[model samples]
Target: MSPTPSHSASRLLILITAGFGLALGAQAASHDDEHASGAHGAASSQEEPKVIAKDSLKQKMAAGKAAAKAEKSDPKAEPTSVSMAELRDLIDQKIAEVRAKQAAAPAVKVVNKSPKPRAVAMSGQVKQSMAAYGAAAVPGLPAGHDLHWEYTGTAGPQSWGQLKPEFKTCSSGTRQSPIDIRDGIKVQLEPIQFDYRPTPFRVIDNGHTVQVNLDPGNNITVSGRRYELVQFHFHRPSEERINGRQYDMVAHLVHKDAQGRLAVVAVLLDQGKEHPMVQLVWNSLPLEKEIEQASPVMLDMNLMLPEQRQYYTYMGSLTTPPCTEGVLWLVLKQPATLSPYQLSVFSRLYANNARPVQSASGRMIKEGQ
Candidate 1:
């Protein structure tokens, strides 16, 4: 029983590839080396071309890669004289000939005799989630289907919990964030020690808000714990309120400690004078969502804050979905100013992305004296 041409070609190609010490360089001298001053070399050179041509497209790609790598590593190696298009044309011609041979050959019939498997019932969790939201039934469903959630419409915050089982905390959590800072007990509280400095930043319009991710070294120390500043983002019509009054916008500076404990500093924004920090971030806004725009200039975090360090503090959850509680919220009392134009720029992108304030629920809030 003799092997087919395809099988024989594949085995020969494998053997050649395994001992691929010599490179197929671009220099004419390298091509000459293939047919060296020996009977053994001359015989190999004659059979090599036919065997290489019969190989599959995968092997051709591998050979092309090997040639490129050899040329790159060797300074004496000449640049590839052939273009990728020419190489592609040569490969296509060989493929067409192979296809023509197959087309001329007689076809054979083969049938599978395996029986069909039984149907499985859907789980109660997935069934409930799909029934509640009319979502697609797919494997590894967390709660709702893998549908993208939004700030408005059917996929908005109201339907966040029902949309996915994992986001159930968003609706069931008792200590959720962005609560109205009213009736807070005034007391002598430790001032949060800010250790911010000028650092390189990357701006991104992440579908929901304009977030600025900063380099390491910027952090804050409060209540005897030091939390590193991860990133900060802007929300229109501010999520949290001070004495029942909502500001124009808010900057949530999120931080985390070594143990993954979270702390958020809210810098409320109002329409007045132009803000240098806000303008710097807006300057680096990407043309499309999810695309990050890096800035050449460094940003000083101190410019983002107000002169008055007085703040109101409380324990709450994140303003967004999967509202996990235990977050330490520090809302700056004196609101920062951004010009009317600055406010309008953000409004155009996200007019109302702020979540409505949640219940204080007898949570004790501390107002810095």
Candidate 2:
């Protein structure tokens, strides 16, 4: 007896429904194994049915189609429609199980990987600062022979002439600076009329001395000529001597006129009270050698002078290099005062920088009577 069309359809539908139920039951069993292993909690089981419905249904349908194709002996064989609600519920359980496992695992922390700061050496930092200033390698030396001279040792004052031919006058000049101002020819010499005012200044650690370059406003008129104050620098152990006595330090206020002739006023420093102008200059000195540092303060040449108007005058050469001659010198008889602390500040930088006093060589030194 052949079956009716409706009956055949009902049987095929029942088979398809059974197969889908079986696939869903297998997926649920797999999730139950995970639950037993304590990978997922009770809350995961409650949310399982909503997590993975669509993907499970599609997979089950693909499986049914494959089965129908394999059993093609019946000409009317086709895939039966099976509701996916149960299959979805089963897959959702597996998804919930995976999510719960992720929540329970220990979390990983990310650490920062920034680089460490580099250390800088003090000497190297000073070198860099000096390089920025385009500082000359040698201080207190001529441009070409910047690196050749020093206070003592090979290029000391004794060998300065031998260091370079241009410096021959350093050893051979007849009239040199820093002579003992004794037994001077007394005369009614005119007093130096100082026209000094506050001017901008910069200090330089020239390796040989701390030189202060000033703005051209200060002037001194003596012997019928005006000399513009150019610069002033320090030398320890007083360059000039009076009655065979050397003071603590001396400042050579170098000046020049429009004709390019040089004049220097030597102010001898004796250890006594604190000098404000000297303090200002020392405070502004640069840490590195051969570097120039401009001060915020202004200096007056008159502040560095003594109350006495008497001075010993002579014609001489520059105490430093090229040893050029024809410089007019005025050594003030009264010494300016500086504290012991002030003297130490310079002594630390230059233990000794004074040029040895040369023979007067029959030079006529005129004293203001």
What is the TM-score of candidate 1?
0.61
Query: Which residue pairs collide in model 1, if any?
Result: 143-165, 144-163, 144-164
- Candidate lDDT values, in order: 0.73, 0.72
RMSD of 1: 18.9
- Could you give the C-alpha RMSD of every candidate to the true structure, in order shown? 18.9, 23.4
- Report the C-alpha lDDT of model 1 over 79-143, residue by residue, as the tens digit: 24133333434445555655665565554221122222211232443233322222123322222
lDDT of 2 by residue, 21-109 (tens): 55455566556666675655664565445334435555555664554444444555433212222333334554466566556554422
TM values, all candidates:
0.61, 0.61
Error of 2 at 77 (Å): 99
| Residue 39, candidate 2: C-alpha displacement in angstroms | 90
